[model samples]
Target: MLAADAVRVVAFAGLAAMIVAGRASLPLIIVVAVVETAAGTLFGTTEHAVLRGIVPAEQLPDAVARNEARGYGVSLVGPPLGGLLFGIAHTLPFVANVFSYLGSMIGVALIRRPMRPAREATPEKYGAALAEGVRFVAGEPFLRAVLFIAAPLNFAINGVIFTIVVSLQRHGTAPAVIGLTETVIGVGGLIGAFAAPMMQRRWRPATLTRLICLVATALLLLSAVLMTGVAAAVPIAVTLFLAPACNAALFGRLAATTPDRLQGRVLSVIFLAAGSASAAAPLLAGLLTTVWSGTATMLIFAAAVAVSAVVATVSHGLRQPAPELTTTRQAP
Candidate 1:
């Protein structure tokens, strides 16, 4: 992960230099974008795995909530800072990102504890190791339900968000207004992160997950009907306000239920499933908006969320308390 961060720092520096020199080519830009994305993914996965390893099971929820809050805090600051830097110079933001990556790398390097899990008794083939993670998640009903509901929920939320941004742009809304909407949503997320530990203490993970899904469904439906930027933003803010608590409970449960050795692969699979859905959402939203209108696109997104809510409501897997990890099977 530190190596990935170093690579990102170099890539950002290169991009900044190219922008300053007016020599940025399409291919170069594409390459840098791809590299940065890969590096960021590696960094994120490693960060989560390390957190799981370093924090005790009893404290995992609060630890994860704090991490979530810090990310929301960054979201609150990063956009305005980026815009300000961009106004000063087009390359300035990239230059700042280079330093950001370097700082992250330094922090990672400063960690003193061992990150790798204790070595297993028997070595496992790479494909078999990957397959084990798949089997583990598939065998767990609660995790399976989470995997199922999260994918569509992610897709719906991303589609609606992209649709709103594009619709606002098409309707000649000021960029500052659109940015303000995002800032409002970020504030809500920050509040959610701070409240997550308390919520976890008050409710079971399954219960919290169900409530969040139901509320999100209603909010999305409201956004679909209202269609105005403020109306859409209000629901988005409320939904984000509940999101961190949901995530802390869900992820903390997963961390407790999976063996340390499988943490990286299991988390990777969970994220990949949801990310795959999100990756296609912007294009899907754009197509729907082009064919109909933003209102129609939002309704479609709401329908998707509604389906997820129904599934969560009915799934026996999600209704029960998550099972604890019983044994660490050696790789065979």
Candidate 2:
């Protein structure tokens, strides 16, 4: 994590310098973007591994919830702050991000706990090590179901969000109002994060999974029905309200069941699975909007969400209870 932060500090600082010197180009921008994304992904995966090590197995749910809350809180403020900084100076936002990574590096340096248990040395080939993680996830029914549900679910949800933004922009809605709508929706996620640990404790995993799916499906459909930003905002807010708890619940189980040695690889695989569909969402949404209309695109995405919900609700793996968190963590 510390190394990842250092990389980001260098990457962002270089980009900011380029912008200030009027040396920024399309290729330079793309390279910087890739470096930053890779560094962020490394930091995130390591952070999860560190959290699992720092917290006891039984308390992983609350730990994950707190982390989710922090992310939600950042989402609420980051865009507005970045935009404002950009308005003041084109390079200001990148400069600010550079400092943020420096701060993160300092914080990581202060952590005293070992991030993983000591294990016997066993060197393996890169491909074999990677395949081990993939095989583990593939063999685990619950984890397999998570990948199955998350792929389409993320695609649909992201598509819906992109469509909403495009629709609002095309309609000539004031920028401030659009930002406010996003803020309101982010608030819902923040509140949901605060409530996640309790929800996990009270609800069975299967029940919670079904509730999240059904509610999201219903609310997404409602958002599609009402095409206006303000009208869609209500349902979008409600839909996001369930997300943090769902993530905490799912990730908590993942942390509990995955071995310490495999944490990074396992998480990488899961993240890739979860994010792969979402990567294409914006382009697909744009194409759909161009071909038909924003409203029609939304309806199509809503239908996709509905299909994912049905699949998730009925999946045998998801219906089964989550693995119990024993005193000793699961072995690799």
Candidate 3:
């Protein structure tokens, strides 16, 4: 996500720079988008490598969760900070974002971790290592269990409709209102993240996610009541919190399940699925907005959350009570 975010940030930055310099073009915009996406993909691959390498086998899940929490925190803070930087100089955000990639690369290089290196390859084995890892994740019980919740949670509930900002704007809401609404949502996630360790003491991470999923689902269902301004804002804000909370738990599970040797590959596969869903949902959302009732759109997202909960609940493998790893630094 950090990497993918940078792509978006740089694309915007590059575009802003062009606009500020009065040298913008359609082609340039496209190029920026392409570069950003490519970098993000690479970052995803490398990031998993770093985490999987560094963390001990028993500690992968919690590490993944903590990472996700930090990510959510960043999401919570970044937009406002980006806006502040942009306010100072049109090019500042993008220029600063480009350097972010460099910093990430530097960090990755400096980090020491125990990663499974590619086996000695025969001529026929060029990409076999990658393929092997993908297949392993595809079959792994714990990792697969996460997809049951994480994939739909992201694709349907989170990705199925316009972003909250877009949704508000579509309803002719103002920026100040959007900012306040967003802040409320971020606060929820932040609170959830801070409480995660303790939350795990009582409930499995998956259990926590299930609870969050239900609340978030209820919130979305309520959002269908959004014929008026009040109905629309609260659910969306709640989702922001719910989504991050669920994500934090899910990442923790993923890390726990992934073998140290295959962390990079497993993480990459997970990210790839996310990227694909992200690529797919906007088109679907646009299509739905054109013909589907607002109630229908809300229902679609609600169903996604419901189904994820069901999957987590019934998956004989995942439904087993979650085990909280009390030893936090078992990996680092």
Candidate 4:
């Protein structure tokens, strides 16, 4: 992960240079996006795995909630800061991203504790190792439920959001207002992240998971029914208010329960499932909006999430008691 961030620093610097030289093109942008995304994915998976080593199992939830808080805090600033820097110079945002990666690399290097447990290198095939991870997750009812709930949830939420943003722009909503909507959403997430630890203590993980689905469905339906950009932002913001607790409950449990060796692969599979759906969402929303009203598009997304809510409500794995976090960390 540290190495991946180092590579990102160099990659983003190269992109900045290309832009400064007026040689940047669509293909260059595409290449940068691909590299950054792949590297970011690697960094994210490794970060989760490494957290297991750094923090005690019982404290993983609080640690994850703090991380979520920090992420939302950054989201509250990163975009507008990037935009300001971009206005100053085309290369400025890229340059700033390069520095951000460098900062992350330094943070990783400063960690004195072992990030991964000692393990002997074996002549294991990569495919076989990956399959083992997949099989492990598939066999675990909790993980399987997470996968099923998360993927479509990501798809629907992202699709509805895209439709809302695009529709807002089409209706000539002020850019500042649109930006403010994002800020409000970020604030909602930030607040949720801060409250997550308490919420986790008070509620079953399954109950929280079900509530997230139900709330998201309700908010999406409200957004569809209202069909006004700024008015819809309220429901969206309220929806985001539940996100941090859900993530901490779900992923914190995952980090606590999953074997260290399978952490990267298990997380990679789940992230890929969710991310693939997200990647397709905007495109599908665009296509849908061309043929149907924005309300209709949002309604379709709400319906999808509603089904997930039902699934989550009856999920047997979720009904089981949350996994005990008493297990010691395992060797990678």
Candidate 5:
């Protein structure tokens, strides 16, 4: 992960230099994007593993909640800041991102504790190790249920969001209004992050998960019915407001249940599933919007999420409490 961070810093710096020198090419940009994405995946997986190692079980919920809040808080600033910097100079935002990566590298370097799990007596091959993680998650009912609902839910929600953006663009919505809409969503996320720890204490993970799904469905339905950019923004903001609590509960349960050594693999699998859906969302949105009106496309997306919510509510596996696991740091 440290190496990945270093690579990311260098990649961003190189991109910035290329842009500044007026020497950026399509192939160079594509190569840098691929490297940056791979590095980010490595960094994120390692970060999750390290968090599990360093934080004690009892405090993990709060720790993770705070981390979520910090990330959302950054989102509140980063987009607008990036826009401002870009306005000043095309390369400035990339330069700023490089500095951010450097800061992350420095922070990682300062961590005093061991990050890796203790070595096994006879380590499994890479493929076998990954397969072991997949089997473990698949065999677990709660985790399986999460994966089932999460993929389609993500697909629909992201598709709807893309449709909304494109619809707004077609309608010639002012750039400031669009920016404000995103800022509202960011503020909502910040509020959710602040409330997540308390919500976790008040509700079980299963109950919280159900509520999240239901609320998202309602919001999407409302957005679809309204069929206005401002109306859509309202629902999106409310959904974002509730999102952090749901994510915190889900991740806290995941961290509590999975063994330290398998944390990275398990998280990687979950993220990959959700990411695959998100990656296809824009294409799906475009196809749907072309076939029907944007409002109709949104309604279809809302229906899809509603189906996921219904499944989540009725699923025996999702309703059951997640299995408890020891939170003690595994010996290294």
Candidate 6:
């Protein structure tokens, strides 16, 4: 609840300040980018908390899959809407985003659950609480192994975000065309998100997770290995489709395993782990490409993700019941 309010306030203030200041500038863009990253990280943490509190143990996976679908559904709307508005005017799309954010504030006002108190430790015990959260996460064999795979994969692929955009521009794709390409990937993700529950019903989350990883990895390898013409775009686009669905399942697993009373702490810890990856991505990506050609770098990243695949394949963690899956209090 607080996080939601903070988003509206920060965004509104930034928008208002930018508008009043007259010219939109690089400084403003950098600030907004920072805020945007923070907002997404915080929102993810909030969603994890909500799932821990509201969803029952058995329903958590389906619940998270549905939430993932809903997010992509929003993406289906937001990206196209932004693209359509961008066609009208660049500044207009941002102004339009402002209105959508305002609508969110109105929706938040309508929420009935009174905001709860600090969800983890007391003020004085924060350090100990933080340590406890870290220790708890370490104790979870499943999560630990998953991260071993995911962290390096995250580390490797993050560079592609910029590298791909740069590669696209180097190939002379227009800005609008890049947006169109993104929309294509978004379409693929929209399809995958809806299909996740059906997929999960038929296959275990771990199995499903592996399948998406394979699809993404194969695509990555293809793009890097082929590196010939516009055809390279196809495989990267395929990778885009698989990433979010896999992430949704991975997070669903995490939410199921975290305790409600410690949900905020645990989720925050997870956010920190992810944020560290993102924080390092650009620098690492730049350093990597400097050491090797872009295509070689991409292939290297593909291989790194393959390491994650192997970890996921071998870890017995994926098959076991989540240790803290239920809402029960810990035994004294």
> Quick one: best lDDT, which candidate?
4
**Backbone clashes in model 2, listed as residue pairs:** none
Clashing pairs in 5: none
Candidate 6, residue 297: the lDDT equals: 70
lDDT of 1 at 268: 84
Per-structure clash totals for the candidates: 0, 0, 9, 0, 0, 0
The candidate 2 region of ten consecutive residues with least summed lDDT is 323-332
lDDT of 2 by residue, 26-123 (tens): 99989989999888888898888666777778888788889889998999889989989999999999999999999888888887777777865876
Model 3, span 1-332: residue lDDT tens: 45565566657666877878899887997898788768767766766655544665456555655765787688878898899997997678777777776677566556554344455465335387679777987787667777566777777654533544455666788878877766666666666665555555567666776777777788877877772353465676666655544565566566555555566777777777766766776667666655865567767777878987787777766665555443223333
For candidate 1, give the lDDT of residue 56: 61
Q: How well does model 3 score by local distance difference test?
A: 0.65
**Reference-based lDDT, each prediction:** 0.84, 0.83, 0.65, 0.85, 0.81, 0.67
User: What C-alpha lDDT, on a 0 to 100 scale, does residue 328 get in candidate 4?
Assistant: 55
Record all residue pairs in model 4 with backbone atoms less than 3 Å apart, i.e. clashing.
none
Worst 10 residues of 1 by lDDT: 323-332
> On a 0 to 100 scale, what is the lDDT of residue 284 in model 6?
64
Clashes of 3: 9
**TM-score, structure 4 vs. true:** 0.95
Error of 5 at 75 (Å): 2.3
Query: Best TM-score goes to which candidate?
Result: 4
Which residue segments of model 1 deviate by more than 4 Å? 120-125, 322-332
lDDT of 6 by residue, 1-332 (tens): 45654674576467656755787677877777678667766766776676655455667667776777777678768766777877875666667666766676677567555333343354538798788788877888777766676776676556665555556666687887666655665666677777766666676667866775666678877777655344556666566566655766677778667655666777677667766776687776666666766687778777767877887778888767645556432222
Say what the RMSD of model 3 is.
4.2
